[model samples]
Target: MRAARPRRRFLGLTATMVSAALSAILAFTVGTAAPAAAATRTVNDIGPVVSSLELNKGYEISRDCGFTGVPQANVIGVLWLFCDTAVSPTGQRVWGTTAGTAQAFTAPSQSLFGDFTDASGNNVVQFIPNPSGFSCGGTLAAWASGIASIPTSSPNPLLIIPYVVMCLNGTNTRPLALRIVDYDYTTNTFSNDSPVGGTGIFTGNPLADNRILGSPVVYNGSLYFYTGLCTSSAFGDCSAGTAQVAKVTLGSTPFAAYNASNQSGGHRWLDPRNYTFSTLAATSGGFTPITPASFDVHRYPAFSGSPFVAIEQDDIGGNITVFSSSSPTGPFTPRFTAAVPCNSTTGDGGLCRAYIGHPESSTSSKLMLSYFQPSDSHGNGHVRTAWIPWS
Candidate 1:
């Protein structure tokens, strides 16, 4: 049940069609309120109103990272962001730049930051490599981590995004680092904190090397996370070739604190000891996809008239799945499924956060996915969208 533009029509209509497409997702959707009038048009025909919410066109620091959904709409001016390192942090390792100045690029020291506004907005950045030096290829691939957003402080109710780097340079054996960033209103910037938490691998924690892939989701006022084993055998694993889903709620000290740990022993919950992450088996129809070394499971539970969890499965195929969950921690059942048209193979590369949009005054939803073609260098990728009807 999908629609494809005719070759001839697609070529001629590229510009005008894009203009018309804008009508369905432009500045009419804001305040989180549904349209007053009932939708009289079919899902495909009805035009959606894009909310006033605009992505800060801050610089894309990573040659690779981008977020799915609208969790970052409120960020004003230039937004600061970070991600795992796929390549070495040294400047001499860079092959070359596609469009920008090559010398302007430097390796991310402990982490990297960028300034962005709406996609149409101008973004500026300066990369300064770590003095201690780093040890990755000149590629920036997606690594495993557990991402969550929590309130920064009282009175302002600002949000802070936390990332637990359980793997380094997309490899499992690498040690983990706990990174935190506080959003400041006065300066419209983020202040990053380092290595607040350390792993117990040396202390013989079996789960120490297992990589975490999912972001934070709220259920009954508590926070939950999804985790899985690193594809690379270098990391420690309780079980090989299997994934584990778990839940960890914010403790009493829910807000961010200096030198404080994000997880307490009682705060984390496992998947009933019987659940596994690979419910969707690998495709067996003679598809020679590249094998992904690592992946993260980002879930979008249904809301606003939709009832599916959009899981962003990176690596092989760069595909995404929509699952239905009666409870936050499944027994998650699979439902609708879609993938980026390009790079539907399980090769050495990976993709993250395929974006999905639920528009106002509409019965259908839009899914935006991104991927890099194997032939490209630096893993430079592009984004595409698909529309699915509610009826």
Candidate 2:
């Protein structure tokens, strides 16, 4: 295990402040404001495009572990990561500090990708609630499997995690219904406490817009999330040609106690089916975002006045682009864009997709960005990261 980095204290905005932020975001995304203008894009040359020596060297076996859509969180200073999995059809979870040198995969597989990704190591979430009390490891759901914990801030004793579930035997209709699963941290094993609300796994054609992408951003009591085009399914194209951002207003909608349960009073998370939302491009940016973009935001302290940075990939998946906003809500003007090349001759020429950022490692000026190569041919779902500088 590596030494943990000193943790940063996350400042939660008060009700009044959050309201003001939302209003500001609304002003730019909708109403009477003119659309944000696009900035002229330049070639990638801000700094050195370096590979994540630690992570790529740590995981990614054939047909497994190294796929894209990498989501992360900083729990108690240790960086927890969950990537797309296929080898055993289980969650690809790992954790470490500074670098991902810790053992993370649950089973050992042959490293056919010719990378030092894994050989079976310690793969539980770094922060095990209470081994003597609750079982964090167990059957996540019956017939349906739950992905790793979605990123969100917990304000109460009960940690509310939004889980993306997949139904087995071709029964999954709505794969995007993020379930607010409760881990029995105070129990002897995980009770799989799924709160009653909008809905869960059921058979039928999955709603085109049912699935929400990426870890959610919680601000001012409401849970902020976005729906994207479904890339991996046999059902109808549930993805919109273009999906905008939306929030699940905790005060109303969904159900009663929505606010209080999610860390309101100090709790948070949303039904994800309905709420108020807007777009990242209307405020600014040269391009409009689309599906599998993995829209995400981060709060950086050194960003002068604006503390938030919006992350997504270019429409063609050629560069990892960003926009800076005052808050989680936006008026997000273009901040930076970098070209991370993809081999056109190899594995579907992924060219890069699912560009995301690491809130735990990014700085005001120097940003930590990552993306994955499609799981085609020899590439077999490899993930790479780089440090991009702000201009």
Candidate 3:
């Protein structure tokens, strides 16, 4: 049976609405200590609580790379933030305006995952690149070793962000790969470390069409990844196709590291064989429309009430909807939908996409939602961070 959830009438994100939302979440919630009773903050810039934890002032350093969850690299008390850059890797020096510029990528380095200090104390970045015209990507072990080779002596090394690779080269063969890149906090330049973690291709046929939908978001301590599988030569084996979810704990030391060290040995994860997928089932026949990719997953602790366990995703119509569930791979119940609070004075109107959440910026009262607004035709836009009540 599904647990009773407290649903809120989310009109818009503001100081006033946030207050009411928190009340609703806590009212029907029963669990650990409730979030703080009060939540009031000044809504600034293009909108309330602009994105990237208020680091960028509506000016995008790189489009769609604004999700800066909990500061990772620390040098002299400075948190070096990590996010993706179309042609290069980007970093932001927290508490200051000293910015790091992006360089070109050999294969146009694509979506990057969260930042973490690695075991060696070096600030390492993990990214999933959409392979373009490029040579054979290197080995997964080499990639892991290269990033691990960075010479730095920090404290905690947090690597990997539950990102699935997609090389998509029908003919080319590369052992399941994910590129591990290193970002120099002091220099701000992104360098391709060693082995390239390329795409994972299962269907040998070109028309097979295997895909991982939406986006990968970390909830609680596990990574919620959804994938769709379809094959042709096998005929009706998977006719209707099967949707499966892979739940990887964040501490798996990134896919590259796991592929390198435990490809055949160590057992750091609970998944059978270090990799067994669970299928997501539908209990009912007809279901409400759902978001393709859940942009943000609030890292609400298990005890922090029921409503707080939510996945925030955006519809194609540009609406940001909230859903609640007991499990990360879930049968989510739609709580409410709200128009993205995006505002702009330049170009066409403002449209927000990529509703990412920053756990470090969240409190008991609110979840920090980061997104890109007023983007160009190519989906390039400045970053905006907003605080939404999620008690």
lDDT winner: 2
Error of 2 at 254 (Å): 15
Better of 1 and 3 by TM-score: 1
Q: Report the lDDT tens digits of candidate 1 across residue range 250-352.
A: 4444432222233242223232333222222211111011111332333333344344243323334434333444554444444444444444222322333
Q: After superposition, how far is residue 31 of candidate 3 from its true place, in Å?
A: 20
Which runs in model 2 stand beyond 4 Å of their true positions?
1-76, 86-160, 168-176, 182-204, 210-213, 228-243, 248-293, 344-351, 374-378
Please list the C-alpha lDDT of all candidates, in the order they appear.
Answer: 0.28, 0.33, 0.31
- Model 1 residue-pair collision total: 23
Predicted structure with the largest TM-score when compared to the true one: 2
Candidate 2 residue-wise lDDT, 1-391, digit = tens: 1111111100010001021112111212312221223343443222211223313444322121111111333222222223322221233433210112221211111111121233354232322221121122331221111112233344312333344332222222233233344432233133443332322211122312333333445466555543333243222111212323434444442223333333232122121232222122222111233222334555555457746666554344455446677765555556555566543223422334545555444456555554554433244444444556554
lDDT of 3 by residue, 1-391 (tens): 1111111001001000011001000001112211121132332223422223223222233333343322245432222232322211234312101122222111111222223323652333233333233333431111111111121244343322222222223334222322234344544444433233222212121111112222344455544433333222121121222223433333434343223333232112123222322111111121133322333444354235633334333332345555555765455455545556554323422334455544444556555555556453223344455655553
Q: What is the C-alpha RMSD of each candidate to the true structure, in Å?
A: 15.8, 12.0, 15.2
When sorted by lDDT, best at the front, the candidate numbers are: 2, 3, 1
Cα lDDT for residue 261, candidate 3: 33
Candidate numbers, best TM-score first, in rank order: 2, 1, 3
List the candidates' TM-scores in order: 0.48, 0.52, 0.46
